[model samples]
Target: MKKVLFSAALFFTACAVSAQESVVKEAKSAKSDPVKAAQIIEPALTDPSTANDPETWKLAGDFQKSIYDDENMKLYLPGGQADTAKLYNSLAKMFEYYTKCDEVEQAKVQSGELKKPKLRKKLAKTLATVRPQLTNAGSDAYNAGNYANALKFFGLYVDAPQNPLFADEDAVKNDTLTPLIANYAALAANSLKDNAAVIKYATIGKEHKEEGYRSLMCLAEAYGKGETPDSAKWLTTIQEGVEKFPSQEYFIGNLMDYYIQKGKIDEGLAQMDAVLAKNSTPYFMYVKGVLQYEKKDYEGAIATFNQIIAEGKDFVAEAYSKIGDCSFFPAQEIVEENSKLSMDDPKYATNEAKIKELYEKALPFYEKAKEAKPDNRQLWGQYLLNIYWKLDKEKYNALEKELGY
Candidate 1:
């Protein structure tokens, strides 16, 4: 019985070695026949006899890398259309196999089962050459609306710099594409509604030059809507965005909307006041005025708009329109209220005169706004129409005709 068992053990050992050698031979054919090579090497990865062997994993990695190279080469051929799914999949598999190989090899080195590192330098060099392709894969996936795959590829690219295989590579450290790719990753995460992922990538991306503003916006949205929302972080991020990207309205609009929704318009005004005190831009002052208007502080809004007008900046026309709005909206409220009152009410005539007086007060400001920016119908057109209809029918008819109304 003991002799029979020994013979059986020897036979299995021979079979294992033969299988390992066969897989390696198949891997060599990967350059010309990668699909068949994959069929053989893929199963060898999990087979009990070859699973722990670093050589098997290395062959697998090399096979996938060869497949990627061949597929990428086809892109330069005449009328060659890339199979993006195949290309991305092969790249991802190459990374995975190489990572597994490295892990196994390192373990063997530590265990003294291997005399020295065999594939580490070759793996590092190959990965350094292949790392940048991750960005292209991510972009293709993103444009194709494959958010999950896009995030995967982008995340791998972002992580490649710190990966052990690229430890000696300066190219990863100096790559200018990192920040842009980070922003794209955040955008992909946002499309997937993966708030945590958005925050993760956007935090890194917010320093990019061209896409930083967009990343900052993504960061704020993630903070506001994450599983356990952090309102303070959301507010701070939006404030930072407003300061960094003053020309973009997204941050400021969302900030104001948050305050309005929370019924904290006064708080919003206070914050804008603090910003204005520090940097006193016409844009921030306009935001403050709008917040004051939302709070129904008409007098405060008019004063803020007047200050913006005094500054004589690009906001002058908007300031004039806002000043007109303050009076015009109040007059509209009076009209609504007067309609509810009985015609015989003694206050009815007084309310009608007050409405007309407010309209008269608004007319000059709207006219000034129109004069300042004749092409900006949004600033003054409807307001002027309302004022003329109430205070002067002849001008109202003429203006209506000119407007094609």
Candidate 2:
């Protein structure tokens, strides 16, 4: 018992320390020893096995963060390390790369190497210049509080590095601007999940998920932002963005989630109709299940999510986790709100009975999620803890002992 208590205490202490230490790690790495920095970076850049190690990734992240934060280091990748013409000229080359990919993809379709998607050759060609166009347009939208427009424009800026879209215009006024602009755009977009601007940027990132790690941040933000938007415009904007950027799973998931949160079942279902037009992805299906869950169509949601868990073998764990999360709170909330009366009082019993039904329905989903994500012990433990919360201490103690929590 003492050992277990000590272990739990130590774990909590470690988590707290990690959180506080993260901020300082960035500051310290700025002036790290050259040999040690190089040693860390070598493994990070080349060793796949060591790729996810925090120490290595953080060292590189800190180095880049410091350079970006440094006013002097905010210069060029396209051309000008310092000069104006060189900087924008380098931007032109990035546009040239966008043009290259666009041309290659378009030509592949025309030459029979790829299927002609709905937004094919013409769309691809237009996107070639999209990056450069957004560089100027997104800043305009951002300053005006039209994050929707800014997000859209920023999406264009992703393919071509020279055209940084998400930063303050003043930042772009310098010769060394791309990294600063890129980082800032990423930051700004991340800060506004429901802002249409975030949806737009994430959509672009979704397509180029392979090359742009920056997109991943925007994708997560877009999903988070759209969950409870302030306006209907945000909903429509995100919906449209998802339709347009099917490959951008981040935006699509966020938009669909918004549909669920707003209690717009029909609208969410309609959006799924849109999702079906393109190659269907987990992001799309996940939204559909969540929408049903929000509507209290538990069976429908569970069945749909079950199909996803089965079909998406690689994503089954995440799929179950989502189902668990989607059902847990909603059922709990309903049960809690209804648990006001005694079981014998007809009025009180009505709500209490409903509460039991909700919990009964919800438990299996959470348990299934736990089973699917066995490695995610913390999440599984939390689910068990919650279940125990609804039960007697004797039962809770028994389960806790069984799980060693």
Candidate 3:
């Protein structure tokens, strides 16, 4: 009877041990299965972020990574919630683990989800909703010295209807986003060297009062910068803008530049004269002087620049430098070239008188400018160089002795 009891006990122990081993194997298998592992690890995601329910929590973590990355991320990270400060913090930590700064991290900060679909429809849609703000942000970016970011925002402003930020913009019956957007669009286009875009945006800007003037600037800058070869087109745009906003000095100045570049010297001069007639800002006069210098009207340029210097408060050393440039480039020599005698001959004495007269006209302006701008190396050098070359031997020798130069 005792031996029978022992056998029964052995059978019971072996059965128990076998059941325990089977349980352990099953647990290992469950842990190895990713889907099951995820479910077992964080079932809250599977039950909540999915599509079957109004609450988007069910598929929150179950998107097919290869196929639905964008979709999943969008679902989890919806637009308004995408780039929150808290969400960004979380994303930053995850990226720090890998020592990388992938756009995915930014998107995660943007969308607030790891399971976001690769296509990112939600973010795009959200972006469309904030179109106006984004456009404004683009302008701000340019103001803040971020050209690339400015271009991006301006692009969104133009294409706002298709973007996620579209709803945030303002549209009117008589005046819509088309014009305002085009203004910013021109600025962006100029920065990016997109000539077509500049034309499109500047046209829109011209529809508005303040922004229109700015748009004209974009047109002028684009042509001046040589990013676009369509100078004629830019000029035409400037003329139209000038006609519409006639009193705007900024637009007039740009128009002057356009005419000069187009080689319409008389028209450019007329424009400058009109501008100067109104109130000769040093800059306008300086530009006029430069135009004269380039056109080989050295005497005319010198006279205009002198008017600026005499005005005292309107101009800077640039005017002085430019005047020196014109005189130093042999304006007197050129007149001598047309004379009837060699410089060393008796007839040349007549030529020398003309040279001295021209030199006298330029000397005091440079000398006075140099004195006023003691720290300006360019002005000082110009004065010294001119003095040494233009004055007679006795006068030059005396001045050099005085200056100890």
Best-matching candidate per lDDT: 1
lDDT of 2 by residue, 1-405 (tens): 999999999998777556445434433573545324433344333443333233443344334333323322344335425442333333333333334434444555667767852322333343343345456656766777765555545544543433322122332333243433444355466756544555554444434424344544454445444666345554554554565556766666766666666767788787677676767766567767767777777778777778888786555665676566665677567666656646676766666556556555666766666677766765556766666667446866876786776
Give lDDT per model, in order: 0.86, 0.54, 0.57
Give the runs in model 2 whose Cα sits over 4 Å from its true position: 1-240, 312-315, 318-338, 343-362, 375-383, 386-395, 398-405
Q: For residue 77, give model 3's deviation from the true position in Å.
A: 18
**Per-prediction TM-score:** 0.75, 0.42, 0.53
The 10 consecutive residues of candidate 1 with the worst lDDT sum are 23-32
Measure candidate 2: CA RMSD: 23.8
Q: Write the per-residue lDDT of candidate 1 for residues 9-82, one digit (tens) a residue.
A: 99999998788777767666664687778777776787766768888888788778877888888899998877
Top-TM-score candidate index: 1
State the lDDT of candidate 3 residue by residue for 1-405, as single tens digits. 999999999988777655544433343355434234333423322222221221222122221111122322553764523332222222222222111212333455456565543323433333333334555556666787776666655654555443332233334123266567667778777877776677666766777765677788787667656644576766776776666666666666677666677788777887777667866577878878878887889889989887887787756566776777676556446564747566677756766676666676667666666667756756656455655666756756755666557
Model 3 TM-score relative to the real fold: 0.53
Off by over 4 Å in 3: 1-129, 136-149, 160-181, 221-228, 241-264, 276-280, 286-307, 316-331, 334-344, 374-380, 390-405
